[model samples]
Target: MRNFEKNIKNKAYAFQLDPMPDSFDKVMDALEKKKKRRFIFWLWILIPGFLIAGGGLLINQMYSSANAQVQAQSLKASHLLTVLFKENKQGLVHEDKYALTETTHTTTPENKMNNRPTSETQSLASKNNQPVFIKESSNQSAEFNNRNEKSFVQIEEKTNMTQVPSREKWTPIIFSNPYFVTFPTHSSNPVYSRTQIPFTKSTLPVIKSNSHQTGRWSIGIYSDLGVSKNIFINNKDSAGFGYTNARQLTDKFLFSYSAGIQFRYSPVKWLAIETGIGFTHYESNQLLSNAGFSWTTSGNNNDPDTALTLSSVDPQSAFGPYEYQNVYDYISIPIKVYYQKKWNWTGIEAGGGIIFDLPVNTHSYVADENSNMSYLRHEVKTSRLNVFGIQASANIHLVFHIKKFGLFAGPTFKYRMNSMFDKNYITRQHNYFIGGEMGLRYHF
Candidate 1:
């Protein structure tokens, strides 16, 4: 080895290394491999997100289409009524084996004074035709008599009647429902006597419509029922009872509940955003098996008259579980974005968002030192839970729309991405929840 080192040192000034272009290609190849891995990771995340969005949009479209169809049906009914009325005015000839006749005429003082034509009278009747209304002025009288389900109408007018003479050029009038209309607001007032009245055309329009439409806002409230899982991750760098293999993993989760009110607005058809206030309750029965307990006298050292009590806890291992329970309650505010789709009367919705949890209360547990080996009860202690934290969640739901009312139900998953405890605490805790939620909604 000494000979080789000496030979290399003696010839070092005379030797020169060559630079190969292949080395640059190797570095570039490594960079391309890293870029491909990054793209794959992003693709995994994007695939499910797009799927959820597509499903939600399809559901929303269905709901919108269903609502529109219902509206169209109602409009069709009204249009049918209008068409029937129009056909009657146009004197359509019916081929049915039924005869119908209607006669309406009015004579005003002005028309008589000006010698203008009074009115046009038309009638049709066949075998077994039903009797219909006949309206006339006070100067004239109408009598309709029915015998054996047969109808007869007679009108007596002082002036000579001018009837439609040609059936080919005649405009026949039919009345399914007949009644007198009150004088319009712009027309003259009623006589309030048994005198002949003239029909007046109103100058003011009725039932005018504009281009305005309803707003794109809605509100809903919901309550969710599901089980929540608890995860306690140990901080390996921390000293003493750091939650590393400290808990008996027998129990995984406990019952959890949440309820909230949401106010949403949609700027377009397929998308919406909502924000709301929520209340959540999380609990766990998972017991700590390696926790430590200690007792120490606490008092002012300078005062001889004061009494001291056992008041300290040691961060060590070896305490056993006895009647232990962990509970946390939080008030949350959530901001979420949704993708929606609809088909027929049903729709789908997918959403993701962040939750800001403000801790309202909790109960921490300590094992009882004097309990029997079989018992898992604990000594109740003050809580050491976090005051405020954050979480993320994704959810998918099926929605059913019934006019202005709706229903939603689906599964959701939540993860507390950050540790609840700060660096001051020995253990780090994260929570995972997988649950189903169902609720009702109202729309305007």
Candidate 2:
């Protein structure tokens, strides 16, 4: 029984049972009853408190910095304006001597009006005892009066000179921004008042004349996705394999692309001379002809009825599946004198030009299948250079203008005067072609 008690004591010690705090059981009971209440308490109290504090601190910092910057900028601008004002004041005082002289003259006029002694002077002149002294003083006063009159005339002349409009001031401001105008000073103002009558009192002239058309320059880059037909230009009587190949190589529905720059001169509102230099690339491929040899082997001796005969003959290559491609890249200089009839935001122009088409790179690639057993089964390719030619264009241009800039797009029917190929093989000349051009223009 003592051992059993000791064992129970050991178990109790292992567990170490202690009494709970006063609120621990109650808090545990509350937590177990509503798990969401604890989360709501923490989220509503701690989270919102932290966010509000952080946001307030950030806003305070930004407002402080912005206010400091604004204050500094305002101080700097005020200082600059003050300096400009002082400089202008000093310049006006130095340039107009009347500013100082007028102040003195105004004070003198006030003094003269207040100190009039005409009756006393007349009584002194009438007294016989002081007649000589009065006469001498009167003569002195008369001389002084004559001198004052001359001085008054001189001051009036100076005022008139100072009143003339200052070209230096107006010229600089006009050149800076001629579009805007500032109101002139009133005649009652103390500073620069007399000079305001000319520019302000006179009504500003109406700008009734139409805007003059200025010179224009434009450049355009375009990728054309169009079909073209490449027809053969050869001598009718050429008796060669090359002529036959050329005729067979011509194809329809080829690819073409062009790039150009156009310059325009506008002599009138609705008329201009448009000209440009441009480059064009035309490409096409076709199956022309194939040349090969054909031969048959002799019959074997196993059959007694077969007769042995030896036959020999010559053979020539014929037209078959030979691939060919022609690429014509030309530089064209076009001069077009056009008339533009302007509508609200668009214009139409129809013009023709004699374009000097300089053949830059004209190459025709020809390839034939190799059927020989000794060599690899590959196609044999050959390239040839071509001669240059001239082309003419008659186009109706449609212009879409936004302000003074415009986009010109038009369909042009082009005709070449000569074939863009070498004359040594096939000498026939192609006389015409058709294409279009789109460009951009800017007017000054």
Candidate 3:
């Protein structure tokens, strides 16, 4: 039995030393190739998924912007039509004029007592201080003579008396037939012609134009909420000693908020320039798989490199689920130009601009796998870290107008145009953000 076991052991040792068959080698190679192919397949799927989602978001934003413009224009047109109708309804209408005539016959007591035919004339003046002449017919005078009694006849012309020409010479005229006179009046008031009128008064209603149609200055308060991420660009020249071997850092989105006061100057109905200062809070969380040395100090000091040491020396300690939390507070100023289309009670606006970020404070911390805080560092010196900087952004907004006030809300996209860190830093940082902003605007 010992000899048989020895033989079996020898056989096993020989088998272990022998080379694998070609088919088995080919199968192993194929498995490795399949693994790579599966990885690439999944990568392709994920990339397109992200792209599709981003495209969908862009499409939605565009659709909403266009819809808002349409609605605003419709509202404006309706309001304009209503105003025009009201003005027309309140307009004044003029009426045409008609001529009038009057006749009168009178017998005075003196004329009757004289028992003799006598002709008497009386002169009268109108409110305009114009003299009027009245004449009696000769036939009436003959009748009075035949009766041996005195009589008088008066005929009044009531055509706009002011329109009648003023004659320096008086001429006598006869009318065989008796005539009646009628005077034209408006609401019991005598009407006068343009020649006699000293002044004219208007009785039309006054309509005020819409104030929103004119351009003006506006002031507003704005607030934003969003997600932000940082991208690191590695530089061999600026990467410090330990950072050369430092594992790649990965970051995730965190909450960001900003609030500010803005001033806008609109020179035309479609264009405006805006500027403002605001307070911003930005937070980001990063993960480092490898442990590294960080600069620290024993006491309160301004020196950035006064002390440097590794937290742990053991290689096992280097394999860590280390977490870094960064919080930055900034005072930001923005300059922008906007193009707007407004309707009666609404408007849509699009704008692009640069923002200047002035850092007020920066706080950084590290935590271990057990969620224990390892270090609290203020102003940790990192390569190429720009505490204050500038960035570019674009925005689209929908506005609801109420008299002199406007309420607005929109989506804003920001891109870092310059590196946030200096050239001496090992890693350069560029930050981008997507956010929603809301605000109230007052016009002057």
TM-score of each: 0.45, 0.40, 0.45
Give the per-residue lDDT of model 1 (tens digit) for 328-356: 78898878888887643467889979888
| Local error of candidate 1 at residue 241 (angstroms) | 8.0
> How many pairs collide in each candidate, listed in order?
22, 3, 12
Worst 10 residues of 3 by lDDT: 168-177
- Candidate 2 runs further than 4 Å off: 1-225, 235-250, 291-320, 365-387, 422-426, 431-433
lDDT string for model 2 (238-291, tens) is: 433343334444455554656677666767655667667788777665443333
Residue 37 displacement in candidate 2 (angstroms): 71
In order, candidate lDDTs are 0.46, 0.38, 0.48
- Ranking of candidates on TM-score, top first: 3, 1, 2
Number of the predicted model whose lDDT against the real structure is largest: 3
> On residues 78-189, what C-alpha lDDT tens digit does candidate 3 reach at each position?
2111101111233321122111112132333224333432254322222221212222322222111113232222232221111111122111111112222211211123
- Which wins on lDDT, candidate 1 or candidate 2? 1
The TM-score of predicted model 1 comes to 0.45
RMSD of each: 21.0, 30.8, 24.7
Instruction: Put the candidates in lDDT order, highest first.
Output: 3, 1, 2
